[model samples]
Structure formats: C-alpha cells, structure tokens
Target: MCNGLLNPAQYREPQALADEHALIFARTWNFVGLLFEQEAGQHRGVKLGATSLIIQCDKQGRPRAFLNVCSHRHAQLCEQGVHRGPIRCPYHSWTYDREGIPAGIPQPQAFPEVIADKSAHRLKEFACETVGQFIFVRLSTDGPSLRDYLGPEYDFLLHASAGMNGLIDEFRQDVHANWKAVIENSLEGYHVPAVHNQTFMKVEGMERGHQAPVDTVQHPLHSSIDHPAAADWLVTFERKIAPKIGSWAWRFPHYTHHLIFPNLTVTSFLGYSFHIQRFEPSAVGITTVHSRTVSVGFTGQSPVGAKMVEQIYAESKSFTERVFAEDAAICRAVQQGLECAERPAVIGNGIEDRVLHFQRAYQRCMNPTSPPPPT
Candidate 1:
C-alpha cells in the first residue's frame, strides 16, 4: 500500500499553486481544443494556468498558438471564443500574420526602429501540435515532443481521434476547488458508491456489490482502467449494430477510462464515443473543467446506423452530465476539508492505485532532484 505523496497544504497554499503553474502546467503539453472542429481563419483564446494564449488556424489550415497579448501595447489580441478574419489588435489596430509577424503597422514612419526589425516585434509564439483531431499547446520551448510526452497513450489517442466524427455536446464549469483536488477525485472509483450512488453506482453492472471486474494499467505519465461492459442492453445493442456502423475495433465490448498525466481524462465505451475532459487551473482555489462529448462514425455508416449512434450519444451525454455534477459537488467538499487539514491523505491499494500513481508523478515533476518515494 502507498500513502499520498502530496502534502495537504499543497492544495490550498498560494505559493504551492504558483510553483505548480511554473513547474508542471507550463512545462507540460496542455490540451487546448479540437483541431478538426476549427474553421479556417478561426481563432480562439484559451488560458493555461495564468498564461493567456490564442489558438488559430493559419491560411494553410495549420493550427498555431501565440501569446494573446499584442506586441504593440500589450493589449489582448482577441477575446475568448471563436472569431473570424485577421488577428488584429483591438487597441491600436495592429495586425499579425499566420507566422506571428507584424504584417501591417498603421504608420510605418512613426517608429523607424520597429520598421527596421519587424521580426523583433512579432507576437510571442508557443509550441503547438496535433494528433488526429486533438490539439495540444506547450508554453516551454524545451521539452519532449507531444508523442514523447504522451508515452503509451499516444497511439490510443490517435485511433480515438480518427474515429471521432464530430462533437455532440460541450460545456465548461468553474468549480470552487483546487485543480489537483478535482483531478485526484477523477483518478479513482472508490467514491462511486458514495458520491455517485444515484448516478454511476446505479448503472447496470455498477451496483454496489455486483460491479464488473476492473483492470488498472499504470505508466510513468498516465493510467487507465478497463472493464467489461456490464450493461446488458447496451452491450447487446452495440454488438448487433456495430457492423453496420463501422468495423468493430475490438473483439469484445468494454469500457475504458484514461488519465493523461497532469490534468486530462478520456473515457469511452466500446470505442463508440469519447468523453474528453480537461481540468484547467484558474487560481489557487479555482479550477475550470472543460468537457466535450464526441461521437465516432465510419465512412460508409448507414442511415439507420447513424440514427442509432445519435440515440446512444444522447443517453451518454445525460449520464455524463449527472456523474460530473456529482463529482463537482464532492470535490468542493473535499477542498473545503483540505483548508484545515494537516495530514497526508491515505491511499488504498485497490481502485485508488491510479491516484497514487498520479501523486507520485506530480512529486517527480515538482521535485525533480528528490529521491523517489518507497513502493
């Protein structure tokens, strides 16, 4: 059995939050948005920790990321949400090209120094990459590539992204809790009986004493849980309709939930649909959960098959929202308790092994030189 590696104070301390923003979030690849959904010449603003960023598609339809602030007077270039047209500064009408270079200056004669070296005044650019439809951004220039950072999850995400046709639903909620608290809650299923008793615990195969067997896979950067589908109706329906919709990827029906290191999770049932969620740290005690559900379809899916997929998506979306609400409420309570807590949390050896795996990874990043915790 392993104990929690993070100190209770780390959840509520301002300085600890700052250290995390710099050491963990900044140095890691953060999930931003879906590349396939963005229109050509569309740009949207996103926040990673305290850093503001703008993700846009260039003329060539390539995804690019840059600091949201204008190079001229430090004004924000675009507001949150998608915008069409050029990346123009609202303050002074300064505009930037796809490569972050200042292409148009209102008065070239006003500042000869800037005109002489336009490259020096370009918007600060960050690293951006995509695997299939998923897009990721990194603030630090020096680090592993997105593939290297994702480790074993890279190939899985690639296949998942390719199968996803489009987004079915999306929402964002600001929770009054530390970001770590929110993520930790998601890494284990021990709370299902209590926190999700009315929702998840009531699922066909998820009843208190009759739950299906679950297998946990742990890696240096990620962890996942796989279990056979317990819902008889869903499993039977999928098996019958899968051939018409697309080639079945797996021999048997199962549910998978994956945690991608720092603060992202991907969940699916039999690869038919994926629920992607990212826990973004907004402040010391505020975290925003950005969630979206995407449907998977094949090239020659029949009309009947498409309608069946839609029905499945509709039910999944409702179930997902209920479970998320339950999780958010419990996470808030956990954060409130941590405000006065002085001891480390206990880690169980069963379902919560993933939680321990995550905490150990966090400790490794936050204290690179420290000796590894005992197994």
Candidate 2:
C-alpha cells in the first residue's frame, strides 16, 4: 500500500491488500492474462497484482505456467522476462526441460539423478484453461471449469470473443487513481451522457442500461450476444458483421469475460464499446488501466466488413480516449481529497450501487469467503 498497509477494517479483513488480492483475484481466475492471436508454442507474459507469469507451450506443446524462477539458484529463468523458447536459464548453464521441469543438473554423477526428478522439478503449474481466445489460470487445479464460473453472461460474447480473425486491438493508459475506481467507472452506464459528453455525441448511447437477460440467467458461460432486432439489422447490413453477437458474461472474481460476470465492464452498441478497463494498481494511489479495443465478427468476415468494423472500433476508441481523460482527472483530484478526509463516506444512487456492490463483495472475502454472489 502507498502509505502503511491498507487499514484492515476499511476492507473486510485484516490481511494486507496484497494478500487479499492474491486470494480473491490471483488464486481465482481474475483475468490472469490473455491469449491473443498467438500460436500454440508462442509465449506471452502477463502480471497478476505484483507477480509475473509466463504462458507458453511445453515440449509436449501444452500450455503451462511457472514462477519464472531458475532451479539452480532461483534466479528468474526469463530475460526481461517472458518469451517463447527452448528457454535457457542465463544464471548458469542449468537447463530446464519443457513443462518447467529442471531437465538436467550440469554434472550427471555429482548430483543424484533422482535429485532432479523431472516430474517434481517441473515448473509449478497453475491450472490453465482457454476460454474463447482468452486464457485463464487458477492457482488451484480443482475448481469450477471456466464456463461454470461464467454463469449466465456466456450467451453474449461467444463469437466476438474469438472475432472472425481471433485478434484483440489494444489501447493502454495510465491513470493516477485506485484500480477500484476504474473498475467502478465501468460497472454501469450511469456516466455515459455526462462523463462521456463528446463520446455520447459522437456515438449513440441513447439506450443506456444492462440487458434484462443478465439478471435472469442462473448460469451461462460463453455466450452470443443475441438481440432480435440487432441480429436482424446485422443481417440486413451485409456491409457489416457476418454474425451478430449481443451479450456479456463473466467468469467471476478475476475476469469478467465481458458478458455475465466479466472481470471488467464493457458496453457494446453497434459494435462500439463504451470501455472494458483493465486496471493495475502499481501503488495504492497509482494505477495503470488499459482500454483494449477488440475487433470482432465484422472485422474478420469480409474486406468491406472489416473496414466498417474498423471504422466503428476506431471511432469508439476516440470517444473512450476523450471521456477517460476526464475520469483520470477526477480520480487524481479524488486521491488528493482522500488524503485529508477522516471518515469519508460516499452517497449512492441507483446506478452508483454497482460500485457499492463490488466493494461489498470484496469485503466479504476478508474474513471468511462470504456466500457466492447472487445468481
């Protein structure tokens, strides 16, 4: 935490903020990382709170994760430090085999061959699952499947999650605010008209609300966004998406797959998204948020279709850039205000309740994992 550790009471329990995060987000599937248009053996690096993780293919070509630590002296086995390979530990010539196992100990007879048990020495693996084009890891291997966690929102993101081309167009921004602030900003469309003045004017957020379908779903994992009129419109416009996707779902706790319980919040209208912010709280008062743009159904379908999709995504990105700047400005100012407050409390409205919901949910985990979130 920026100052001392965060006040335990302020959150639900006494553990430090870092510990709580590992429990709620890290151990769970909290958007640990993503698998872009990467090949089976290609490697990519991602961070969870403060830890670095590598996602890559093993010699068997299976996806695996390791602490990125070298076996000999525990030096990081990576360069800057993630890339696909025949990875060679730079510390010593100690080479680890695929699957993160220490393949060989330099001198054969000096060390007992049994001392370097390939199975036991292998890189510690967290259970990994690929959902659509995204990748998720749970520190614990035995839990719900990713879909089981997604619950109801799965109906909406199925197709676009892969896009026709299976790629994600990304935009990253650093905001001087708490990670929670950015997540709260995205939960509801409450700020669309005012917070996004130019964006709203440029795009149409005329209808602002979460879909009723989300409330009714008991459990939905990967879903297709299905709106009758929107579906019809997509077909009507051959110049646009080959298929129409309409909903958002979630995998809970860590990652919201942009559908039901998505790790982040997203709004999609005419393939123009409001924002799906990914926040990294470097310190209590500092956070980095990435506003990633996803190219979906339309982009990969046809040349004309891809152009139209790109045009929409580009326009959406512009609006997001403008409005989010305002959000950053407000958050910066709020941090300064909190510095002086004694016991500050926030007022809540119908839409503002979303933030309260997240905070309450986070608090529940501090002492005992409270009840699972309502279906």
Candidate 3:
C-alpha cells in the first residue's frame, strides 16, 4: 500500500490551486482538440487555466495556436466554438494571418509605428503540435516537446489516434470538486463497484467475479491499466463483429485506460472506440470535465456492418454518459469531505495503485525537491 502524498487541505486551498496552475498546467502540454475536427480557415477557442488560446487550421491545412486576444484592442477574436472566415478582431477590423501577424489594419496610416514594426504588434503565439489526429498546446514558451513529455505513451496515442475516424459525441460538465479529487476518482477502480454498479460494473463479462485480472503499466509521468477481455458473450460478439465491420487492423481485444499526467484520460474497449476526457481546473473547487467519444470506421463498405457499428457506438455513448454522471456525483461528495477532513487519505496496492502513481507524479511536479514516497 502507498500513503497519499497530498494533504486534504491542498484540495481546497486557494494558494495550492494557484501553484498548480503555474507549476503544473502552464508547464505541461494541454490537450486542445483533434486536428481532424478543425476545417481549413476554422478556429476554435480553448482555455488553459486563465490563458485563452485559439487553435486554428490555416489555409495551408496546418494546425496553429495563438493567443485569443487581438493585438489592436486586446479583445477576444473568437468565441468558444467553431468559427469560419478570418481571425479578425470584433472591436476593430484588424485581421491576423495564420502566423498570428497583423495582416490587415482598418486604418493603417493612422498607426505608422505598427506599420514600421509589425512584428511587435503581432498576436502572441504559443507552441502547438499534433500527434496523429490530436492537437496540444503549451502556454509557456519553453519546455519539453509534446512527444518527449508523453514519453512511452507517445506511441500508444499515435496508434490510438490512427484508429479513430471521427467524434460521435461530445459534452462538458462542471463538477463541484477540486480537480485532483476528480482525477483521483478516475485513477482507481475501487469505486466502480459502488459508483458505477449499474453502468460499468454491469458490462457483459465485467462483473466482479468474471472480470479478468488487470495489468498495470507505470511510467515516470503516466500510468495505464489493461483489462483483458474475459472469454464471455461480449468477447465472442466483438471477435465475430470486428472483422466483419472492417475495424482497424491494429486494434486491441481488451479494455485499456491511460492517464496522461496532470488531467487527461484516454480509454478504449477493443481499440475500435475511444473516450478522451480532460479534467480542467476552472477554480479552486470547480473542475470542468470535457469528454468526447470517437469510433473506428467500417472500411469493408458493408451496409449491414455499418449499421451494426452505428448501433454499437450509440450504445457505448449512452453507457459512457451514464458512468460519467455517476462519477461526477461521487467526486462532488469526495470534495465536500475533503473540505472538512483533517487526515491524509490512504491508497491501496491492488486496483488503486494507479491512483497512488498519479499522486506521486503530482507531488514531484509541485515540489520537485521532495523525496519519493515509500512504497
């Protein structure tokens, strides 16, 4: 068993939250959206802590990220959703190019200083990169590249991304809990029997008695669990239907859940479908959970197979949403308890080992000088 490194007060303290925003979120590669989702000349706004960014696809069909604020009047260029046309400021007719340089000025002659030195007036650009279909941005100008930051998980994400065709469902909800509490809840399966009894626990062949042993993989910055499919009705159904539907050639036959540091989770069942979730800290006690589900396409061009895949995707989305709602309720209760509790929580060695792994990573990031917690 591993003892928790983070104290209960850290979950609800204002200073601790601020420190996390600076030392953790700002320095890390934050997931923005999928590159395939953005069309050419389209831009979408996203937030990393207090920093707002615009992840846009250029005319050349390349992904770029820039500060959402315009150079002329510092007004927001785009709203939260997808927008087409140019990245023009609403306050003035100032337009920015793909490089975030001011390309069009309504009254250029009025400001000769900007005309002389346009580089000084350009919108602040940040580091952005893509791994397969995913797009990530870093607020700080300097840090490890996204690939290096992801370490061994880089190959896993690349393979998973290649299998995904497009998103089928997306939603965001505000959980009344600290971000750590929300993430910790997801890192462990200890609560599944209680919180997800009706949804996840009830999945065919996933019952407490019938489930296969989970294989855990731990990295310096990330962790994952792979639950091999049991030899039951569901596994048999997947084996028969997968090849018929022309699923990805490189797909897994098990359920795998991955946690990429600070607050991102990528989970898949049989590698044909994926659920990408991010727990973004909105405030000291509020977390915004952004979730989207994507599925592999039918390449065999069978109408019957396509129909089957659609039905499966629909059922998967419904089940995922139900489990998310249940987890949110439990996370809220955990946060409430943390606010009044005085002792540190203990972690188990079995199913909850990943939770302990996450806590250790959090501590290492927030306090680099601290020694590792004893196992």
Most accurate candidate by lDDT = 3
Q: What tens digits encode model 2's per-residue C-alpha lDDT throughout 85-134?
A: 55567776676655666665667676575374666666666777766655
Cα RMSD to the true fold for all candidates: 2.3, 6.7, 1.8
Clashes of each: 0, 33, 0
Judging by TM-score against the true structure, name the best candidate.
3
Clashes of 1: 0
lDDT for 304 (candidate 2): 58
Worst-scoring 10-residue span by lDDT in model 3: 208-217
| Per-residue lDDT over 258-360 for candidate 3, one digit per residue giving the tens place of the 0 to 100 score | 8888788999877778899988888889999999998765567467778888888899989988998899899889999999989889888787777878888
Q: Model 3's lDDT to the true fold?
A: 0.83
TM-score of every candidate? 0.92, 0.72, 0.95
- Full-model lDDT, candidate 1: 0.83
352 Cα displacement, candidate 1 (Å)? 0.6
Error of 1 at 308 (Å): 2.4
